[model samples]
Target: MLADYIHFMKDDFWFIVPALWFIGYACKRTPFIPDWLIVWILLCIGVLASCFFYGWSVRAIADGVIATGIAVFSHQIVKQTSARDQIE
Candidate 1:
């Protein structure tokens, strides 16, 4: 299971993950857009961008969603941990 995940990360999701992270982080800084809308827009961009590589297949879309989720999860982990540490 671990190997499979590593393979997926190396072959499919490496670039998309970081790119989406940066996009989301940048979007979060914009005050004009509501926070709720930022994530949805970022996910859509990730999915659409993946289509360029996978040519509109289900796999492409799935990979995009997974990558985006991973990026968001990682961001939240860092954010929450840092906040908790600061409180101490």
Candidate 2:
């Protein structure tokens, strides 16, 4: 099952995930960009970055989507976990 998802990632392309995380952080700190728009911005940037690194292909696009999803989901998980602790 895990092997099926391997194509969604490439060793060199894994850098995109952390890069997106930092970019998302910068976007979060920006006063001009609305919160809702950050995700869309990240998505667009992710796809473009993926294409730039992997070349324009359907798999590149897929990897971008997955990478972005991973980055955002990871941020949320950390954020929520920390917040939950604070509530205790």
Candidate 3:
């Protein structure tokens, strides 16, 4: 059973690589947008990634990583924005 699942993932590894990379890039480019918007965008990405990769299943690890990435990305934006606001 586990081997079957592993095989499925191996076949889809190519798709997952690009998807994860794009998520990282989007997080990096969050400065041009609002914090709330970034949160929503990340949530959408998480949902889509879950649906695509897991179908009707739940993925704790993937979801956690996605949420953590969004939180870290948004934290940096908030820090930079606060600094800019203080300067102004």
Candidate 4:
């Protein structure tokens, strides 16, 4: 089971590249938007594409949602850490 999961991840990881491309395009198309939420959206897109390629529809959707939430949480954490570091 673990080997199967490893193989799936290895094969479907390329989907993330296209997802990042989409995010870049979105940023290029709308230069005025400074919203960092786009990062979470992009990761969700990546997760969807990964799921479509891997044949795990339910897991992919749920993971994508979870990934988005994590992205947001991580983003804020990074921002806070950077601000704190800059003050020191």
- The model with the greatest TM-score is 2
Per-residue alpha-carbon lDDT of candidate 2 for residues 1-88, written as tens digits (9 for 90 to 100): 4345557687678788889999999999999999999999999999999998889999899889988988888888889978996877
lDDT of 4 by residue, 1-88 (tens): 2233333334445345545655646764796856665775676676776577666777666555444444445556667978996877
Candidate 4 residue pairs that clash? none
Candidate 2 global CA lDDT score: 0.87
Better of 1 and 3 by lDDT: 1
Worst-scoring 10-residue span by lDDT in model 1: 1-10
Candidates ranked by TM-score, best first?
Answer: 2, 1, 4, 3
Candidate 3 clashing pairs, residues 3+ apart or interchain: none
Candidate 4's displacement at residue 47, Å, is 3.8
C-alpha lDDT of all candidate models, in order: 0.76, 0.87, 0.53, 0.57
* Model 3 C-alpha lDDT per residue in residues 33-82, reported as the tens digit of each score: 76456555655665566566656455633553454454445556667978
Give the C-alpha miss distance for residue 55 in model 1, angstroms.
0.6
Candidate 1 residues 1-88, lDDT tens each?
A: 2244545533755788788888887888988888888778878987887878778988888777767767777788789978996877
lDDT accuracy of residue 74 in candidate 3: 54
How would the candidate models be sorted by lDDT, starting from the highest? 2, 1, 4, 3
Candidate 2 positional error at 1, Å: 13
